[model samples]
Target: MAFQWQVDPEDLFVERYPQMVGTGLPAADVDEVRAAITDMWPDRSGGWVHEWSRLAGRYAAAGSPWRAALAYGWAKFPALADTPKRTALSRQVDQYLLAAPDFDVAFDRIIVDAPYGGGHVAVPVHVLTPPGWSAADPVLLASGGVDSWKMDLHGWFTELALRTGMRVLAFDIPGTGETSMPLSADRGFDVVRALIDHARTLGGGRVAHLGISMGGYFSARSGLAGEVDAAIVLGGPVERSFDPDRTWAYGMRGIVGNALGFDTEPTDTELAQRMSAFTLRQWLDQDRNAPMLVLNGADDVHIPQADTLVFKGRPETEVLLIPGTGHCAVSKFPEALRIMIDWLVASARW
Candidate 1:
């Protein structure tokens, strides 16, 4: 609960910085992080990594494991296949594990068979049993976005665990975090299906999927594939998500490009074709899907409102569009999370 690091409201990096600071750092330590990041503005290397790493060490030395973990994670944000990025990621996991005991959760790192390609991959799943949890209780497979890894969503997982007494399994989607799989346009839902299969073994063959941002795309797809009993897609893109004509910001484009394994940024046309592999509209068959809830911010820049609109009148689907909020309606995350959890509980009961 040390997420107090606040960035300036008017900061140019406001698009990504606020969530970065809000989710990962303590409020009291906000100034130091802000100052360091400011000094390293427009630079992802050199002093930037050093500043965050030093800050992380300071927090670790002070026994604030969560802050340390977040600092390390920030050090690797907008990940690149580099030594420093890899080191920061490893340290982030280490600090997160160091903080897990305090939260009363048993963290386990394991490997599961990827449903595609006949390959095995490592997935770090955080396991938390809420009070009154039973072996027959259902499980929630929680996931995060491109910039925010599974570690970033730990708080959300704990909230779901407490709210429903369901065992929560937090894992990275195929391309992010410690998931040992190559990133591809068609990689996510298969990985999630594999995870759902794994979740069933832990909880009486009952599991639900909830995902944020790009993970929401996978959650929606999982529901369409009947991979899970219930699914919630928060700020996920379905139709326009692949349209080259839909304007995307530099950072958003970077994330999509990077996730698809491009060594360099791809042309908009190439990016469109690459992303086309993920378009769900063409594959959707309403009769074969599970009940789903699609929610997003009316102002979400990365995901167009059209994405949410396309789900309208779809069988067993409900959509919530909040005005004046940004991507995934992250500004209303706590409220949205409550709604998501309640729906999951109700969906499971049905």
Candidate 2:
């Protein structure tokens, strides 16, 4: 479908996939995502941007006008209905992505940041190392933010963390959780390298990066820097669906924060145009053919499956089509875990 698909011009870009209608991130990840998003310390963390989301919301209301009705499909602003200045973010994708993998069973907590002065932000990671866990465990950075809000945030991490009893590490990065690094590519890659260094201390080797939705871009950058053993992108986006101005929520946030380094906010539509600046083509240029698993819902409207359809790797590459779900919905589906876990463990590629 072209950027402008329907004739109605009603403003709803795509209908929410039925299977994903009530789905969400894992419970544990949800708490973490909420904490990171809610724990905004203005200026206390110099590099971090505060209230970027609110600015985005206000801009959306002023510019898109139709997004409010679209976002209303998700949550209710029961208490703040009359608050004039508040950002309409309950529907923002980031709000739901970070929670997951109930460590209903407690595990060890360790710090993943460095002690030296060069490190700008200190990030702590939760390490769940089950007994008899191998040293060569696949560690997912576990991004709990907007892009992944609709990805397989919970189902992938929960089953692997709980049932397979594999050694899994979940860390939140700046602009994400705890650590607040600048959005510059160089700085973000540094954090991934540092995370690997931190994991090394805990005896995690042959680390694999699992990138989901928006998380795929960062993971690709990490792979470019040789920080990971292999990478898997579930429901990964290889290309960006053009944002025709105020077409996306985070585009508005980037505008408010002047994230592109401009002094003033970019127009809503301008923000949308820039949203696709990062693409999988740039990330996969090295073509390491690092083991990747790409799964998509046949009905996914937000991110068309074609974006992730191509790859150089032969046997190591795998794709699955869950009949009824979109994005993260497959992970939540009871049988979906069975299919995914069996593949991961069976492949034992990592």
Candidate 3:
């Protein structure tokens, strides 16, 4: 069966354009690529991947590796399902590495062993250390959603490092980006635990976690398990999103399926069955939890509001529902980032 998109691809392009620019893509380049995209799925000219790749090549030839990386990032934009998209992801990584040396903050890309399914998987992580950072400072493990992987979040990570004077560790969550493992609720936690363990080795061993979008699910799990010093869940689903009766909006179902490592789109029943294993309800009743901050836009179309509300009565947890915004409070991200950074600084002191 053919994959069906919940939202029209053309409309999605228009809706996501602002977010692309917000995340650091040049406006003029994005406009050119947007104008060239007549087919969203085809692999040839006028297709999403083709046009974006064309722009990426131009940027690369012009000695603008960062811009090339951003363009290639959009080429792989929602998922890495097809060959062209996967190729785009490869180029994205190459361009990002090429641009890394010029980053304002110093960083190191290291590989750590993450235990998974009776063995270990090599996980690539980017650790950025701010000026004057020392062993006495704290560390933060940060990650983005299924679609926006580690490289896509470089700006946010750098900003956090610079503003907080904390070492920022960024990695792709399981089943996304360069992670070798597929998404399985039980196994995914193992990957996160491994990251936490590695994080504890850096700085003062005071570690925090910041998860955005689907990445928030892992952060919530780490918090509930008391694995990190603090955890930030920004627009992540904790419970209701996995309910069989819950519905997805704006093509989230298919997008999630692709991130879940599905070769083809799964039926609603199959999706629900798989997703149910991801809910954190069983852990909610537990007494132990890290200091947690749960945040999301009140009108998030992707995640149910109940997911953020679920933390209301939990001890040592702060929940914020930004009004008049959408998922992750993208429209008001600067405000949200300030709140998150302040919370992290305070959490570290404790």
Better of 1 and 3 by lDDT: 3
Write down the TM-score of every candidate: 0.89, 0.59, 0.95
184-205 in candidate 3: lDDT tens per residue? 7879889889888989898899
What range of 10 consecutive residues in model 3 has the weakest lDDT sum?
1-10
Best TM-score among the predictions, by candidate number: 3
As a TM-score, model 2 comes out at 0.59
Worst 10-residue lDDT window, candidate 2: 1-10
Among these predictions, the greatest lDDT belongs to: 3
Cα lDDT, all candidates: 0.73, 0.45, 0.86
lDDT of 2 by residue, 90-118 (tens): 34323222222333323555666543236
Say what the RMSD of model 3 is. Answer: 1.9
Model 1: CA > 4 A from native = 1-12, 38-46, 347-349
Who is ahead in lDDT, 1 or 2?
Answer: 1
Backbone atom clashes (below 3 Å) for every candidate: 4, 12, 0
160-236 per-residue lDDT for model 1 (tens digits): 88887888888877667777464555655667777898999998778888888888888888877778888888988
lDDT score for residue 162 of model 2: 65
Instruction: Give the local distance difference test score of model 3.
Output: 0.86
